[model samples]
Structures are given as structure tokens and as C-alpha cells.
Target chain A: MLNIENIDVNYGAIRALVQVSLEVNEGEIVALIGANGAGKSTTLRSISGLVKPQSGKIIFEGKEIHNFPPHKVVEIGISQVPEGRRVFPLMTVLENLELGAFSRKDRAGIKEDINNIFLRFPRLEERKQQPAGTLSGGEQQMLAIGRALMSRPKLLLMDEPSMGLAPMLVQEIFNIVKEINQTGTTILLVEQNARMALSIANRAYVLETGSLAMSGSAKELAENEEVQKAYLGH
Target chain B: MLSNFFVQLMNGIALGSTYALIALGYTMVYGIILLINFAHGEIFMSGAFVGLILVTVFHVHIIIAFLGAMLFCMIMGVIIEKIAYKPLRRSTRLAALISAIGVSIFLSNLANLIFGANPTSYPPTKEILFPVKSFELFAGAQVTNLQILIIATSAILMIILQYFIKNTRIGKAMRATSQDYDTAALMGINVNKIISYTFAIGSSLAAAGGVLVGIYFGVVKYNMGTLVGLKAFTAAVLGGIGSIPGAMFGGIALGIGEMFAVAIGLSSYRDAIAFGILIIVLLVKPTGLFGTEIQKKV
Candidate 1:
């Protein structure tokens, strides 16, 4: 479980996020949907400790992790797949996955997890030795997800996994997210793709210009008026 | 005579090994941080001085003195990282490079003040490395035990270094970070810690190279590493600025090239030979022999 309460974040003097509160229970897929410029990604970054909140707290499990460094946040069981599919381009596809489990200790488990990811993304398995930059966008997204899965995170934070994917690939990526959630790992997904996000989310929050606009069960939020016009294309 | 040729070849190996070691420092640091640690040579020189002072003042065992040089250089390397590098991590490569030059001048002048402008040598010794049997390769042409040791030690260190980079945990982290920094941090790798370790290892290797140069050349003096470090950086650039194996190849090639210049009766141009090769390589293949070719997104 995770709790982010009344967190404020800024970029130097410019404020980025106002007091925003959100929570995700264990075994849940919580989607934060918004248009461009929403503070969704910033919120995820704040939890991951990349953005030091101006004055707010992010509690992962039971510990206060606001002051933790970016690396320490991952060590504490939250893995982030950043937007833009920024895979380590020079590294081999396999090397990228190996870095995912960097702080892990169980050697056998690491190997097993890699095999599982390869099974999920067979295309990656086929091009294991190739440089990641050579991968197609969809394959790179798969690799990004596979790399995060290698971290064995208890809670996965994804920022725009479907950002640049084809329509069919978008559904495939979301299905994979659902599959990952079914395995009992909690996920906090942030996306501009609201219809698909709320389509699969257990609970959803609408982030609008650095503020949490609304929160409800996925079905109810899908029928909400603003959510319909702004995000769902209804 | 054939003897002269064999002697020159042995000397080449000795010089090549030292260059290879120093070049490793340059390439490793450059690979991880994309900044050329120009003061690397000063670090090597400082190692030699530290070892010399320790041996002369305390009468420490030669082995311990060499290792002490390594330890001292390693710590100094970490200190350099803290002061010279970490602050400029997010800055432009040009700034970091200028900072490295600043560090270079600072250390060199500091040593000049403390040790004086006069060149210092090792404490008077009855024996340097044990003089062993000289093997006659040709009539009156011979390889002494010291040259053999220098060549052998350098080759061994290069081999060990190759193994360390290719197959180690921290090595992987270094490689990962070198390839992608933000992603490495996402995996919980302390990127700065890995970089500090790189400098420490590189400086340690340079320390060993310093001691070997001291013994092989039958002298240890301040400012020795200046020429050697410059040549080593040339080697790094020649082989590929950010490639480890490239450094070794570059170092050895420069060494042999320098010796070849001397052998060809152009000893005055010995320094020029290394620089010449670097220029040619950069012009022809900007990414040295072992360097990874990167394509920038248009």
C-alpha cells in the first residue's frame, strides 16, 4: 500500500504541484488519468524520490520515503518506467533487464524472473543481444516494462507506458499491465489515455493541471461528465 | 646488430605497459563521466612521490611502499572525485574538462612548492629490483631481469584489468551507468559511487605503473608523470576515448611507436610520434578501435 498526502512539489521557484493526496491499496491497479501538463508524472517522480517535495510526505508501505534518494526509493520496492521509453540505448536488451534487478540479492530468482520476462516479451528474447536502441517502439515499451518487472518491485509506477504506441499495441500494453496486476503486484499507472486506463483500472483519479480533480471507482469516473468530454472522447 | 633491435623491443614493452596503465585511468573515467581527468597524470606523479617519501623516511619495505603508493593514490583519486567531479556532474563536458585542467595545475604547482622545482629521485639504494641473469637474445644483445619484470608485470596487470572490467558486479554497474545514467539510478545503482570506485581503481593502476616506470627507467622524479600522462591520454584518444580495451591497444601501440621512433634514429620526435598517431586515428576513426559507435538522434 502507498499513501501520498497533501504533497507539494516545485521546479526551482516555479511550483509544479499543489497539495495532492492519493492512495493505492495492495493488489490494486490505480490509474491517474489526465491531459498534457497534469502533475501525474511529477507525483510519480515525487514518490520515487527524484523530485524532493516542497513540503510533503510519501509513505510507501509504512515508512516515510520523501527524503529517500531516487535509488533508495527503488530499493524500497517501487520501480518506475519513465516516459519516452528511455532505454539504455547503447546496452544490449539483456543488459537493460539485468540492470533492472541491480539491487537484488537472489541470483537464482533474478535469472528466473528474466526468463519470465522473456516469455512475456518473446521479441526481446529473440533480440537479447542486440542494442536496445534498435528495438521498435512497441518492443522498446515491452522491454521497458520487462526491465521494471525484473526489479521485482512490490509496487510498480508507470508513467505513460502507452504514450507513443499504435492503437493495437496500446491495448496489448494495457493488457500486460492488467496481467502484471493479476500477479498481485500493486501498480500506480499514470496516463493521458483515459478511456483505456479507466477501462481496466480498479480505482481512478483525474489529475488536472497539478490538482486532483476527482476520484472514484473506474466505471463511475468513466461516466463522469468532465472525464467523458476531456479524456474519454465521449 | 640484432642485439640492439631486441633491446629496443624489450624497452618498448616496458614503456607500453606504463602507458597502458595510465591510459586505463583516462579511458575509464572518461567512459563513466564523459570528462577527461587531465590531472590523472599528476595523480600518478603524486603516487610516485608518496611512495618515495614513505620509503625514504620510514624505511618501509619496497613492496609495502608500492602498495602504500597505490592506497594513497586511491584515496587521492576519491578526493579528486569529491571536489573536482561530483559538483560538476550535471554541468557541461567543457566545464568538467576545464575543472580537470584546474585540478592538474593545482596539484602540479602544489607538488612543486612542497618538493621544490628540483627533480627528486628514490632514496639511495644498494639494489633496486634484484639484478638477475641477462638472457642473450643475440651476440652481445641481451634482456635484463628488470626489463623482463617490467614487461611481465605490465602484461599481467593488463590481463587482470581486462578480466575485472568484463566480469565484475561493480564493473557491470559502471558499464550500465556509462551507457545510461538515469536508468542506472532507477535500478538503485549509486552512479557517483561507481564513478568514485572507477577513479580509485584507475589511480591504483596508475600507481603501479608509476612504480614500474620508476624501476624500469632506474629513476623516480617529480613531473615524470606529466609526459607519461599526456602520452597516455594520447593513447586513450588514439584507441577511443571511452573504451577500456581501446586504451590498452592505444597504450601499447604508442609505446611501440615511441620506441620505434627512437629505434629509427628520430629520438627527438619520440613525443611527436604518439601525438601523430592520435591525430590520424581521430581523423580517420573518431571513435577509436574499441569504442562503441553512437548515433545521435536527428
Candidate 2:
């Protein structure tokens, strides 16, 4: 549902993304894998409109969305769970979720969805009244996903959701990602954890220093010897 | 002797109330926009002069005129934010600070042209709405009609303000916006609208304080804002610059401290004490009593 074509992003003198292109179709989890500073995050950021590209276009569904601001991007049914799980530390867990649905007017449905999120992640429900900042790293990651899900986005762009979690929590998150895909919500995920990401993704792109270096089915990429040696630590 | 202390206490409350009112504006504006509106004092002064003209020359009802002055000041505040602030929202806070000072100078000098330098006495008044019914809250205190009015009006205003901030949907948006601008925007909250709302609320409070001062002291001047605004700023800082309730505590504390300092035969040190208390508060409780300690990373 999201198409990006030859996007270029810069931070003043530094070129972050150079002529990069990617796409995530409906009901698919597309993974962008790269090392630190490989432009994976920048690509997602450009798509979300947090970082406007100097060149090229972003099409959500069928409309060009390169000009929209980050908030307006959310309104257009693309929600981003920013890197670092930037949940409002002072707000209650519930408040963070309420903020997730900020662009929607569907009050009762939003409320029901929130309840389902709590049910889906029982730990969050137990600490619902607590400030989000106080949650454990795993719980905070769950909170971040829950918050993103609040918007009921057509496409959820997750940036490194598995960055700092334990192995079991990482698996749990990937399981939830699959469950989310089963519910028909498309996701564009950027990750440094290529092994886990490829395991769950149907299709994947290897982003190397701001440009797409490789693209194939997740199984083929995982089986590729060079990919196995470099990304999978085999 | 006890009556003298009572008199001092009454003066403290009156002075404190004014400080509280202005400080509320400071806190509110600062909280939402993360701005230090140096022009706020001038806004208060401008409101006073506006009220003065309405009452003396325009012959408007004291009540409706009060509303009119506040509304006028509120609009001015919004306009100032639109002109001086909205454009500079993404710029550094220092730039916003300088722009605020520029607006302050503009408003004050404009008032100087309109009202002139001489102090204008609020046309002699027989009390229509006394701020409070004069009574002995305690046996030894002597509360005048004016002091009572100042205390009552301030208390009522504060209560109304508290209710607005705590229970309203707009208030929730304000708190959310104050916490995080980008995040608040992502949540479909219009950040600019909320910032303008903050300016409106703050300016109205200053207008109310200006009118109350006129009714209490029986004189309003173009320069009255300098002293009151500075004290209110001091209170805002003392309480915790971006904290809502901290401003109240700081304002009242500054007021009582100022009055007590003068009462103790240290009238020469009035300004000194206000500034000193502020310095001490900053050095000690930088967050102010009610301010959040979390340093919000923008």
C-alpha cells in the first residue's frame, strides 16, 4: 500500500539516503535491513514525512504523499513508531494509546481497539495507570506498538522495534507482527536484526549506505551465503 | 500593634493576588509555547491603560468595560503571538525571547503616546462590587474594602482558572501540547491553535489584574505594568517558570515577602527582596514547587 521511488534525504552536508526505492503492498510485512547508518531508518522517515526528501516521491495507496507533514501522514493512514520508543514519559499508558488514535473520529471503535490491545498485551493492562516511561524495556516496546495500533493505520512503519529487547521478547514482538499482519494491517519495518526480521517478513530489502543493495523473498535472502555470513552472523 | 500586622497581611494578600494573576499568565503562556513572553508585562500595562480609557473617556460600565478590556487585550495577545511568535515557532527560544522584548517595547511606548506619562487616577469610585466583604478574618487584622476586594477577586479568579485547566478538554490538549509539540500534532491536536489559546488566556488574566489594581489603588498609569510585570515574572521563575500552580505559589510568596519586608522597616529593600527570593528559589528549587522536574527533550 506504500510505494517509495528514488527518494534522496540529507542532513545538511551529510547525504543520508541516495536514490533509494522500496515498497510494501497490502497485508504484507516488508522489512528493510541495514547496519547502523545504512539509511534504513532514513528511508522510513522520508516515507512518514518526518524527513522530507530532496528528490523523488512517496505514494501511499495511490496518492503522492511526499509533501505531507508527519502528522498529516498519520491522518492519511500511515503511523510511525519512531526509533527509541518515544512514548510520552509523563503520560499514563492509556494516554499514550489515546494519542495514537489522534487522527481518527471513530471514538467507540478506538476504545474497543484499545481494550483489545490491552488484552493482547496483558502486562500493559496491569500497568495501564502507570507512566509509560516507567515500563520495562520489553513493556515499553509493547506500549509503543500498542500506541501505533491505536491509529488503525493502513500501514504501520516500525523503526527498530526489536532494538533493545531480550531474545524471547524479540520473538514475542515478531509473533505479534505476524498476528498484526493476519489482521490485514500492512507494515513497513526497518531493522538491524536481519535474522529475526527475515524470518517473519515475506519480502526484504538490504539497504547499504542509503541505497537498495539487494531484494528477494525472505527465504532466498536468508539462504544467500553472503547474507548468511554478514547479517545472520553465521 | 496586632492591627498593624493585620494591615500588613491584607497588603500582602492584595499584592500577592496581583502577582498571582500576572504569574498565571506567565506560567500558562510559557507552559504551552515554551516561551518567555517579555512583552507580557507590557500587555498587562496596555490592558490597564485600555481599561482606563474605557472607564474615564468612553464611559462604559465598569463590568462590561472590564470584559471589553480583557477581550481587547486577549485579541492583542493573540495578534502578538501570530505576528511575533507563529512565524518564529521553529526558531530558537532565544529568538522568540528577543521578539517578545521587541513587542513589549512597542506596546509600552504606544501606551506612553496614548495615556502620557502622568499617573491617571481611576475616576473616583463608590464601591459597586466590593472584592470581599470587609471582616476580621482574625481579630488583630484591619482589612480595608479595597484589600478585601483584591483578595476575593484574586481567589475567585484563581478558582475559576483551576477549574478551566483541570477539567476541560481544551485543558487536556494544552497539557498534551505542553508535553510534546510534535507528538501532540501527531495526535491531531492543532499546536498553533493551542498556543494562541494560551496567549489569549494569559493576556486576559493580566487584564483582570490591571483592572483590579486600578480599583484597589485608585490610580492606573502607563508604567504600572513595569513593577507588576517584573514581580509577576519573578513569581513565575520563583515558582517554576513553566508550572501553572508554581506561579500561584510564587506570586503569593513574593507578595507576602514584599509586604513583610516593607512592614519590618525594610522598605528600601523591596525590589531587592523580590529579586533575592527569585535567585534563592532558582538556586534551590529550580523546578519550582509545582513544576515538573522532567526536562522535556524537544
Per-residue CA lDDT of model 1 for A1-234, tens digit only, reads 899999999886767789999999999999999888889888988988777898878998899999998889889899989887778886789888988888898999999999999988999999999999899999999999999888889999999999989999999999999999999889999998998898889999988888889999999999989889989887
Q: Go through the candidates in order and give each one's C-alpha lDDT.
A: 0.86, 0.84
Error of 1 at B15 (Å): 1.4
Task: For model 2, name the residue pairs that clash.
Answer: B131-B149
Query: In candidate 1, which residue ranges exceed 4 Å CA deviation?
Result: A6-8, A12-20, A35-39, A89-94, A122-136, A207-215, A224-229, B1-9, B91-95, B123-126, B132-144, B277-285, B293-298
How would you encode candidate 2's per-residue C-alpha lDDT over A162-220 as one tens digit per residue? 98999998999999988988998998888899998999999999988888889998999
Q: Lowest-scoring 10 consecutive residues by lDDT in candidate 2 chain B?
A: B125-134
lDDT of 1 by residue, B83-114 (tens): 98889876778988999999988888888888
